[model samples]
Target: MINKMEAKHLDFYYKDTQALFNINLPVEKNAVTALIGPSGCGKSTFLRTLNRMNDVIEKTKVVGEVLMDNKNIYDPDVDPVELRKKVGMVFQQPNPFPISIFDNIAYGPRIHGIKNKQKLQELVESSLKSAALWDEVKDRLHDSALGLSGGQQQRLVIARVLAVEPEMILMDEPASALDPISTSKLEELVRELKNNYTIVIVTHNMQQAARISDYTSFFLNGKLIEYDQTNIIFTAPREKQTEDYITGRFG
Candidate 1:
C-alpha cells in the first residue's frame, strides 16, 4: 500500500522540555492506524505534527520531516492553511459550531469560496450522509448545532471535516467522551470511512484500537516501541515494553 504520510526522525520540544524523541512512522493510505500509549506519551503530539497543527503552539520547536504524499509539510513554501485543508482533524470532545447545522457543514466550502446555495446544499447533504449523520439532522438543518446529542455533534464535526474533502482524518480520542452506544457508532463509522480516507487515531482505549484499527503503533515516552499489524501488536509484540504496556503491567 502507498504511504499517505511519513514521519522521519521526528522530535518535538515544548520550551525546554523534549516531548517526542526520534519517532518515525508511515501512515498507510485508506487504512485506520491507531496510535496507542498511556497518557502524556506524546501520542496526541505526534498526531499534530502530520498536518502541522503544532506550529501554532508558542515556544514549541519541531525537528525532522512530516512528509505528506512525498511533500514536506514543514517546508517554507508549504501553506499551513492548505495543508490543514488536506488534513482535517476531529478533537476528543465534539465541538460543533455555534450556528445552524447546515451552516456548520457548509463552513469549509464557504471559506474555500463556494458560493452557490444549491452547491452548498448538495455538499452538506452528501457530507452528512457520508458521516452517517444526514438522517438524524435532515429535519433540523436550520437548528442550532448545540441542540444535538453528543454523538450527533461528533458526527456533525465529522461531516464538517468531510465537507472539505480531506485526504486524511486525524482523530484524537474521538469517542472518549461518548457513551457506550455512541462510541460503538463512532467506531463503526470509522470502519466505514477507511474505504475513502486515511485515518490516524490517537486512542487510550486498547481494546478499541485492537477492535477497529488495521495497523497499530505503540509509543512509550515519546518513542515508538512497536509498529505492526493490530493482531501482532496485541498478541505478540516484539518489544518487552510493548508487551508490558499492552498486558497492563505498566505504561
Candidate 2:
C-alpha cells in the first residue's frame, strides 16, 4: 500500500506544556485509519498537525515533520490554507452553516472562486451525492440546513468538505453526536469514501474503530503504543498495553 501521508518524530507543545512526544505514523492512501485512545491522549492533536489546524491556537509549537507527497507540510514556506483545502476536516459535531442546504455544500467551492451558477449547482449535486445525502435533501436544497436531523446534518457537513475535492479527510469523533442508526450510516459512508479519499479518524468507540478502520493506532498518555492492521491490533496486539486497552483492562 502507498503511504499518502507520514509523520516522523512529531512532537507538539501548547505554551509551555508538552502534549505529544516522538510520534510516527504512515497513512495509507485510499484507506481508513483509526486513532483510538482515551481523552487528552494527543489523537486529536496529532490529527490537527496533518493540516496545521493546531496553528490556530496561541503559543503552540510543533517539532518534527508531517509529510504529504514527500514534502513536509510543516515547512515555513508551505501555505496552510492551501494545505487545508487539500486536507479537509469533519468535526465531532455537525456544524453546518445556518444557510440553505445547497449553500452549505456550495460554500467551499464558492469561496474557491467557482461563481458560475451551473458549475456551483453541479458541484453541490455531486458532493451531496458523494456524501450519500443528496436524495434526502435534494428537494429541500433551498431550505435552512439547521432544519435537517443530526445525522443528516453530519452527512451534510461531510458533503461540504467534499465540495473542495480534498485528497484527505480527517475526522475527529465524527459520529459521537449521532444515534446508533446514524453512526451505522456514517460508518458505511466512511467505507465508501476510502475508495477516493484517505481518511484518518479519531474515535473513542473501540467497536467503531474495529468496524470501519483498515488500520488502527493505539495511543496512551500522549504516546503511540502500537499501530497495525485492525485485525492484528484487536486480536493479537504486540504490546501488553495495547492488548490491555483493547481488552478493556485500562486505557
Candidate 3:
C-alpha cells in the first residue's frame, strides 16, 4: 500500500512525562485512518506529532521520526509553517474567526501572498464547495462566520483548511460538539474529503471510526494495541486489549 505518511518509532515527551511511546503507524494516501482510544490514551498526542504540532508545547520533545512523503518532518531544516500548510488541522471546537465566511476561507491564502481578488474569490467558492457548505452559505459569504450554526462553523473551519490546498487533514474529534444530524453531515463530508486528501482522525467514538475509516489504529496508555483494516479491527482484532476496548469491557 502507498503511504502518505508514517510514524516510525515515534516517542514524545512533555518535559519529563512521556506521552507517546514508539508509535509506528502508516497513513495511506487519500484514505481515512482513524486513531481510536479512550481519553488520555495518547491519540491526540500522536495526531499532533504528525505535523509537529507538539513543537509548540513548552519543553516538549519528539524523538524518532514522523515522515511525510518519506522525509522526516521533525528534521531541523523542515519549516514548521510550510509543514502545517500541507498538514492542516481541525480541532474539536468550531473556531471561526468572527469574520466574514468569505474572509475566513481566504485567510490562509492571503497569508501566503495571493493578492488577486478574482483568485481569492474562486478559492473561497471552491473551498466552501469542497467542504459541502457552499450552497447553504453562497449568498451569505459576506456574513459573519459566527452567525452560522455549529455544524456550519465547523465546515467553515474545514473550508478554511482546504483553501490552503493541504495534502492531509488531521481532525481531532471534529464532530464531537455537534448534534446527531450535524454529526452525520460532518461524517458525510469526511467520507467525501478522503477522495482528495489523506485523513487522520482521532476519535473517542468507536462507531464513528467503524463507519468512516478505511483503517484503524487502537491506542492505549500511549501505545498502539492494534493496527488493521477497519473491518478486521472491528470484527476480528488480533489483540485482546483491542477487543476489550471495542467491546466496551474496559477503556
User: Whose lDDT is greatest here?
Assistant: 3
- What residue runs in model 3 are displaced by over 4 Å at the alpha carbon? none
Off by over 4 Å in 2: none
Candidate 3's clash total is 0
Candidate 3 pairs with clashing backbones: none
Candidate 1 lDDT by residue in tens digits, 99-199: 99999999999999999999999999999999999999899999999999999999999999999999999999999999999999999999999999999
**Candidate 3 residue 139 C-alpha distance from true site, Å:** 0.5
lDDT of 2 by residue, 99-207 (tens): 9999998899989999999999999999999999999989989999999999999999999999999999999999999999999999999999999999999999999
Count of clashes, each model: 0, 0, 0
Give all candidates' CA lDDT scores: 0.95, 0.95, 0.96
Q: Tell me the TM-score of model 2.
A: 0.99
Judge candidate 3 at residue 45 and give its lDDT. 95
For model 2, what is the error of residue 33's alpha carbon versus the real structure, in angstroms, after optimal superposition? Answer: 0.5
Evaluate residue 134 in candidate 3 and report its C-alpha lDDT on the 0 to 100 scale: 100
Candidate 2 accuracy as lDDT: 0.95
Residue range with the least summed lDDT across 10 consecutive positions in model 2: 242-251
For residue 245, give model 1's deviation from the true position in Å: 0.8
